[model samples]
Target: MPYIPLEDHLPGITGLLEYSKDTAAPIRELTQTLLRGPSTLTEGERELIATIVSHRNQCTFCVTAHTAAADILLGEEETSTKVKQDISTAPVSDKMKALLTIASLAQESGKSVTPESVQKAKDAGATDIEIHDTVLIAALFCLYNRYVDGLSTVTPTDPAFYKGLGERLKNNGYNRLPEGYEHLKK
Candidate 1:
C-alpha cells in the first residue's frame, strides 16, 4: 500500500537513501555510526529524542521501535511509567528534555526552534557537539517517520516486538532488517 509499488520498497531506510545512494549512503552510514557512537547524550537520551519525535509525527513504527530502544537502555523499572508519559517530563535528564524540546519544535515547525532553546541547552551543560547531534538526529527521524508512514506498512502495538528489537536497532540499525523483512520487499 505504499505510494510506490511493493517491489520498490527496499526495506529499512533504503528508499530515503536512494536519492543520494552515493552520498546519502555514506551520510546514513555516518549517522548510524553516530547513533551508537560516543557522545554527551547517553544512548537512552538519544533514544528519547527519537521516541519523542516519532510520537509527535505519529509514526507508529518509529515510536514503537524507539520506545523499545528506550526500554532496553533504561530498563523496565524506569521505562514502565514512561511508556504512558510525555517524553518532555519523562524520568530522564534535563538535557534530554531540552533535546526533546528542540526535536518537538523541529517536528511542529522547523523554524520554531528559537535561539533561546539552544541557549537553554547550552546553559544546561549540553556541549556544542551535543546540540548539533540532537538537531541532526531530529532531522533524520523526520525523514524516517515519513518513510514508515508513507509506506502504509503494518504496525503492531505489542511491546515485545520493540523489546526484542532494541539490541539490534541499537547496534546494527536499518542495515539489517528484522526477520522475514526481506520477503516484504518482494
Candidate 2:
C-alpha cells in the first residue's frame, strides 16, 4: 500500500497525481515542455537524459517509465538498454555522452557541473540551449524521482505494461492524456 492512501489501482506518479491534481497539472506541463517540446535534442535524447538521471538517482519507477519513453522515441529498445548499461560506451553520439556526463553531475549536485563539463558538451557540438535543457531535465528528474519514491507509490512489475504505456505516450504526446488515462484526472 502507498504511504498515504491514494485512489485504488493507480501506479507510480499517477497515483500521487490522482491524490493531488493541483500538483499534478504543473508537473505534467513541465514534463510536456521539457520532454515533448521542440528542441535540437530529439524527444528520445531528452528522455534518455531523464532515464540516465533517474537511474543514477536509483529511482526505479522514474527510470522504468522514462526508459520506456526513450525506447519508444528511439524506435529501438536496445539503444536505451545499452545507454542504461553504460552511457560512456553506448552507441549514441559523442555529444550525448558529454551531456549525460553533465546530467550525472547534476544528479549528484548542480555545483558539480563545472565549467569543464560545459566545455566538453560544447566541444561535442552541444549548443547553449541543449546544455541548458539537459541540465534542466536532469534536475527536474531528481525532483520527480524523489516525489515518486518518497510517496511509496505503487510500481507495476510487468514489463509489457510499460511498453504499452510507452507506445501510448509516443502516439498521444504528453499534452493530452492517452485513451484510458482519462480516469486519472479529477
Candidate 3:
C-alpha cells in the first residue's frame, strides 16, 4: 500500500531508485558515494547512523534496511539487532557505540546533540574526522528519512527483503542495485 506505485515488491527506497533511474539517478549516485566512496567511517558505523536517524524519524524502510546493513557489517545478526535496539549496551567497541549514541541524539533533535554528545564521542576515542562524518551521516539520513517517508514511498515490513538486500548493499552499495534485483518478485 504505497502512496505511489512501486515497481519492486518490497516497495522501499530501492524501488523508488529503480523506478526513477531517469530522474533521480544523480541523487542515487551521490548517496551511494557518500556511503561507500571515501571515508574512514566503517560500513557498520554508517549504517548505524542511518538506522538511528531513521529511528528518530520513525521511517520504516531506513530503520529496517540499515539495521540489516549494520548487522551484515558486524557479521552477526544477534549483535546487529542488539546494537540497533540500543547502541549503548552493544558489544561494539566503546568508540562505535558512542558514535551510534551521538547519531541517535542528532536524529532525535538536530540541535539536541549537545556539545556533550560531541565530547562524549571524543572521550570514547572518536577522531575529528569520525565526529564530522558522524554528523554528516546523521544529517544525510534525516533528509533520506523524510524523502522516503514523506513521499509515502513503498516501505515494506518484510525482514528477509531488507536482510538479503543488506548483504548486497554492504558488499557493493547503492551505486547500482544488485544484479537480479528484479527477482524481488512477490
Candidate 4:
C-alpha cells in the first residue's frame, strides 16, 4: 500500500502522477524531452542511464520499468543487466561507458561529478550536450527514484506489467499517461 491513497490499478510513478496531474505535467514533459527528444544518445542509452540510477538508488519499480525500456530500445536485455551489474564490463561503446560514468557520479552527488569524468566522456566523443544531458538525466532520475520510493507507491511484481510498460514507454514516450488512466484525474 502507498503511504497515501493511490489508484490500485496504477503502480509506481503512475500512481503518484495520477495523484496530482498538475505536478505530473511538467515532470512528464521534461522526461519526454530528455529521454525521447532528439539527441546523439539513443533512447536505449538514456534509458540505461535511468536504469542504472534507479538500480543504485534501490528503487525497484524504476529499475524494472527502465530496464525493460532499455531492453526494448537497445534490442537486448543483457545490456541492462550487465550495466546494473557492472558498467565497466557492459558491452556498450566507449562513449556510452564514459557517459554512464558521469551519470553514476551525478547519482552519488552533483558535486561528485569530476572534471576528469567529463574529459573522459569528451575523449570518447561525448559532446557538450551529451555530457550535460547525462548529468541532468541522472539528477532527474534521482528525484524520481526518491519520489516513487518516498511515497511508497505500488510496485507490481508481475513481469508482464513491466514488459507492457516498456513497450508503451518505447512507443509513446512520457508525454502523458495512456488513455483509460485519466479517470483518476477527474
Candidate 4 error regions (>4 Å): 178-186
Tens digit per residue, CA lDDT, model 1, 136-181: 8888888878877876655655666566667767666645343524
Instruction: Write candidate 4's Cα lDDT for 1-186 as tens digits.
Output: 799998887889988887899999999999999999999999999999999999999999999999999999988888999999889999999999999989999999999999999999999999999998999999999999999999999898999989999998998889775574756443
Q: Which candidate comes out best when scored by TM-score?
A: 4
Model 2 per-residue lDDT tens digits across residues 4-43: 9986667887778767878888888988898888898999
**How many clashing residue pairs are found in candidate 2?**
0
Residue 135 shift from truth in candidate 4, angstroms: 0.4
Candidate with maximal lDDT = 4
lDDT of 4 at 39: 94
lDDT for 126 in candidate 3 is 92
Q: Model 2: how far is 52 from its true place, Å?
A: 0.5
Model 1: runs farther than 4 Å from truth?
Answer: 5-24, 77-84, 177-186
Order candidates by lDDT, high to low. Answer: 4, 2, 3, 1
Evaluation by TM-score, superior candidate among 1 and 3 = 3
Colliding pairs, model 3? 11-154
Model 1: worst 10 consecutive residues (lDDT sum): 6-15
Candidate 4 backbone collisions, by pair: none
